[model samples]
Target: MTVQLSGRLQAIADLVTCRAVLADVGTDHAHLPVWLCETGKIKSAIAMDVRKGPLLRAETSVRLAGLEDRIQLRLSDGLEQLRAGEADSIVIAGMGGILIRTILQKCPDRAASAKELILGPQSDPDQVRRQAQNLHFRIDREDFIREDGKYYPLIHLIPGEEEAAYAEEELFFGPCLLRDRNPVLKEYLLRRMRTTGQILEGLKKHSTESSRRRAEELGKEKRLLEAALNRYEM
Candidate 1:
């Protein structure tokens, strides 16, 4: 049998190297935990979800993988069922930035105990990064992956504050992605720049200052993106 995850989720799993157990919050199919345990990435893991339906699915997957003992399924909301220091690593994926922040806020102590945190928010990654920053979680690493025509950012963090603040440009365009200059990342940004430029052009027809300002920001992004592409080409 073969187990697989979306490219973004697999990238998240590849980011951290921890010897301790993992708690995959919002684990829908329990694939991440099962893969981790099956591949010896983690000794064991707890697959948790808010509802019973997904948890049941996770249970079945675990059983089919013959890992019922190694992968425990928990029915709880967010990290409510997880205790502080229960797991050294926590992974939260396939959720909105607001919900992810809410989960972290509800379990601030758990965040403190864990050595690493891997989060993949479906939207508004800047808001998520800001929340993590405010919580004194220093970014250990970040990656961007494309799957099903959508761009996903996988962020890893630890309990500490950043020495220097991240700029708006850095926040909107992931710092790691900007620095890495991966071809796929550049392609994604280029597409975004073009799409936003078109929107900005359309909004300019309405003659609103707010829209104009946003358009100008988008224009700047277009230029920045072009420069990044140029730099990468060189």
Candidate 2:
């Protein structure tokens, strides 16, 4: 039987390039790795999670899928237990952007060795982009998915040299997604625009210096979102 993944996890799995040794960081149930392995997308995988409970769940899933030999379960904090050259591609998903950044920061050499880095940050995606750029991982592709009334972006990066710098809009919104003019991205931007407008309106009632500065920041962000939306003729 095939392992079923949620829309969010399926979106992340879809971004994985096939036929590589895969490592799924924070693999709560090891669903992604199991699906990939069971489907013959990848021959081997490392299913890792920080918490023992989650790792146990992953172990059970791996056993139930009859992929215990192919999918190795490890209790690891980020890439700490993983060595370089162990995995060709790494999937770090379902974590906050800041935590993801920290994971990459802690293991530069191991992370750089991977051919691909697929990241799904739950919050502060821009920070993830910035961190990846700083590590010289050029974004190969980006995708957006709306699941459970929430928007999530999947960033695919590869080790490469950067030819140019990303603008504020490109950094805030993914460069590939912006260029693709994804409808989901447009919807997300419009939602952000509406939220920013509300924040700006609330700031107007306060005359404090901090509120004024915050309002200015939000106004700038609102304009950026508007520009992005305009590109899609939305």
Candidate 3:
């Protein structure tokens, strides 16, 4: 089977470091596991999903790739079905950050046992980062992807001390991304600032107390975005 991932998934797959085994949560089509196994990056992988439909599809993909023995398919909610030390690297992606964080919180032992946890959070990346810290996992690195007009945040976390490796704002944005002045992140901020500008302009047309409060909030956000972009400036 020839599994070609989207650019977003390919980026996540490229960052995967599977020395022994890999467990893919929310493996809709098992594309990542199939691709990794086909490329010799992983000898074995467990493709799991909360729904039976996806798991069935994943099984078909695995079988077609001639990796039915190599890739195991399971119907699991989050990481509940996985046990500690069973997988060297675990990937929980293509889901909301809250659900992702909840999965980690619910299965700390399974999450902590992995050498690496590759997270693809669709929203609330900051909350996920904070949760990872609370679970004794530090953010190893971060990646930002803009695909099909949507923003995706990929956070790679490993079990370790929750060191002060990031400032408050870095946690909100991303430590690695801001430190490197990533062009994608800068563009995301610019887009957000522009939207806030438009909202503020609309708020100006209103004279309600709520509108005033919203304008103030957006003004603060605009200022913060500008300050973050200032670092990227020469």
Q: lDDT ranking from best to worst?
A: 2, 3, 1
For candidate 3, list the clashing residue pairs, or say none: none
Which segments of model 3 are wrong by more than 4 Å?
Answer: none
TM-score for all models, in order of appearance: 0.88, 0.95, 0.93
- Give lDDT tens digits, candidate 2, residues 1-234: 658989988888788884879999999989999998988889999999999999999988989988878988888999998999899999998989999999999998888989999999988888899999888999999999899898888999998966788877887788889889988998899899889999999998999999999999898889889878877873
Q: Each candidate: RMSD to true structure?
A: 2.6, 1.5, 1.7
lDDT of 2 at 51: 98
Candidate 2 has its poorest 10 consecutive residues by lDDT at: 225-234
Q: What is the lDDT of residue 8 in candidate 3?
A: 95
lDDT of 3 by residue, 47-104 (tens): 9999999988898898888998889898898898998899999999898888998998
Error of 1 at 121 (Å): 1.0
TM-score leaderboard ranking:
2, 3, 1
**Candidate 3 Cα lDDT to native:** 0.88
Model 3 TM-score is: 0.93
